[model samples]
Target: MKEFEEPTLSADAVLAGLSLAGRVRYAAVGLAGLTVALLVGALWATEPSLPLRTHVAFGGIVAAGLGWAGFAGWTLTRRVPLFARDRVIAGVLALTFSGATAVGLVLVAATRGGTTAVLTASATGLVLVTAALALLVTGRRRRAELLRRKAALTGR
Candidate 1:
């Protein structure tokens, strides 16, 4: 019986894996987030009688959204070859942000006696955290696989 063999991948093919469509999607998401954060920040700043907690909430949203937009922009502009490391970094950021948001939502729900809106937001947060975790695991696996392929190609 013949043994199974992995297909060879060229460096160009590897580099081309990041499609233009994907880059455009990332840019769109980053721009949208930046726009939303700026708008919300402006409104938040102008609200003179807002509660302290509301201010904090708005600030958190703005910070998190900006962070996401900045990361996306950085990912799109970097010239150095990441060799799948970017995916890992993105996954980590996503997980951290989503996990924090989830915990905050849960706390808010607790403090507010679990109102429907708060509970719904908490559920959404949990879903995001779950998705982030999946991303992290997938990224790690992809990085490992790429490294292994690199080692094989280089006879290391």
Candidate 2:
């Protein structure tokens, strides 16, 4: 008997996946642009009349964070599988943001301006930071799960 072979799919059938992928990509691009715009606007809206030392410190923090972001991106791209990279990055970022927010809240409470009115915001910020921490934990779990699935798929 002749050996059986796999049937080939038609061109349209093979490549017709994700009809709205282009739209999704376009929307992602638009969203990314908007995020950048909002970030720049927030940075620009900083009070120019603030103390020179505060401005310098803010600049240093921004520079360091940007450098760290770049390094993280490089590490993710080189070391992470494409499918898991996003979750890994999101997890790492969420932890960092949550930790930073927690520190900020602590500092605010230690400062003289930590009145009850201002502390209301501290509660909200804390809640968000807690949620972010939860997200980070979930993302890490997802990454682990994905790794296990991949290993199983490869029979490793």
Candidate 3:
């Protein structure tokens, strides 16, 4: 039986894979997230009568939205040269956001006596954190592989 091998990509092929349209989409998403976060933060700041729980929820939303925007901005600015590095950064951002979200959800659930809705949300948050962790590990491995390939190609 023959073993299947992964196809090796050249630097040109990697660059060619990056699409202008994709970058534009990322920019749009980033802008939208930033705008939403700003609006929410403004509303939260202005509302003096909001309960502590409401404030905490609003803060979490703003933080997560800002994180998403930051990742998107990084992706848009980095271009093709740092695609692997960008992935690693994205993974880190995702992990941070998801882990925070998971912790927050767990706290909320604990405070609320573990209501079904809160528990479900907590579970979802945990799933997201797990996925983010997977992304981080995969990104690191891919970056290592790319570096090794580059070193070999350059006879370093």
Candidate 4:
């Protein structure tokens, strides 16, 4: 008589099985979700004036976000020296850039005949961006701590 056993996989093993291309796909999907969110938010909160140019711009923004997400994920996984620093800077830049974009979108959406909508959208975008920036700083600090620990343990 012979007994057979099934193989078990560890979490690390499962994650390692995911190729870089797969990771990129996953990130793109996430970016797509965010794009949908932004589009929905725009439609929900502002007046309706959807145009072809606006849709195209939104698509571009989503593509950019997808690229950024893939790059960020790849860098995080590779864990190269100074990647954390770079991530933090990039994240801050992303927050500011996206925030500005959101403001512009909101303003255009709200534009009925005046700048009141623009001002309101700008304020909203500022708050959202500041929060995102704070999150980026926190992530950077965590990465810095991890790097310190690694250096100490390896005596590098």
Candidate 5:
């Protein structure tokens, strides 16, 4: 009688299987990395705190950037042509998301008041903006991809 064991895969080979779990894991890692960077920046950023206008501006930028990231990731992974014009959009989206998170950290740090209000508000805003933009971008990318694929199949 003999016992056999499955061979282990190399790190690179294992990584090649960017399945749903892997993708999600990578995305999470990306988000976490961005958050840490932003926190550091906020800790170091100077001044009596950012104005409301700055918050709004940064928020908007974040939304746009996250939206783009979602869209680009969706398009590329799904092999969609909707946003095939440029890969820069994806990079921009990533940058914006990181910037927004960092600015939020600065705002939180600058708040003279306790973190109760700031933490709750920032958490809510972050979730809403991130989810909204990401979903919107993904939805649009999927729709566009479907349409393109359908057209190609039907010779439309």
Candidate 6:
């Protein structure tokens, strides 16, 4: 489909969206960089080598980075309202759920300390990683498609 510009979009509206989008974009970049840095830092600090157990946590960090970047980029390319006041609500909801899940996971690990619990945690982490990858891939595809449409329209 051809991309359509919003004729009613004001200068202020454009600025507002760019401002919000910029913030999210910067955040995503920062997160991804930090995750990579931390992984590298851990490796550097290790004397000989790190254990496989450590890689699991690193995987989670990488997943989080990818997910954050994907979502943020997706937010940036979308209509302004998607990243404006409404986005604050979405952010809060996301934070609440994520925080609760982390707490629950911790509690579960603490209360049920055993090989089974470890395995369960590992499984959960893998699931989260998979989900994040899904988000990353889909977001990239959607944004690319959007840009392709926009470019086609503008070029004509």
Q: Count clashing residue pairs per candidate.
A: 0, 0, 0, 0, 0, 0
List model 6 lDDT by residue over 1-114, tens digit each: 999986885433543455656676657665675677567556645634655545554555555555555565555566653324334433443454355445456556766687
- Which is the better candidate, 5 or 6, if ranked by TM-score? 6
Candidate 5: give the clashing pairs: none
Query: What is candidate 6's TM-score against the reference?
Result: 0.37
Cα lDDT tens digits, model 4, 2-90, are: 79988985333333334578557646655665666576556544745667666656655655565555555654465334424544765
In model 4, which runs have C-alpha deviations exceeding 4 angstroms? 1-56, 68-97, 106-115
Judged by whole-model lDDT over C-alpha atoms, candidate 2 comes out at 0.57
Deviating ranges (above 4 Å) for candidate 1: 1-17, 114-124
Q: Specify the poorest-scoring 10-residue window by lDDT in model 6.
A: 81-90
Best by lDDT: 1
Give each model a TM-score: 0.79, 0.55, 0.74, 0.51, 0.30, 0.37
Which pairs, if any, clash in model 1?
Answer: none
For residues 8-96, could you state the per-residue lDDT of candidate 3 as single tens digits? 97664554444778788878879977998999999998997999888888998898789779878877766355636767987898898
Check candidate 2 and list the clashing pairs.
Answer: none
TM-score of candidate 1 to 2 decimals:
0.79
Task: Give the distance in Å from residue 100's predicted Cα in candidate 1 to where it truly belongs.
Answer: 1.8
Candidate 6, residue 40: how far the Cα is off, in Å:
5.2
Model 5 TM-score relative to the real fold: 0.30
**Candidate 3, poorest ten consecutive residues by summed lDDT:** 10-19
Worst 10 residues of 2 by lDDT: 10-19
How many residue pairs of model 3 clash at the backbone?
A: 0
Steric clash pairs (candidate 6): none
Please provide, for model 5 over 2-116, each residue's C-alpha lDDT reduced to its tens digit, 9 standing for 90 to 100.
7898998533343233457645754764565456545544543543377776656555644554464455355436532333233344444544665566566557655754677
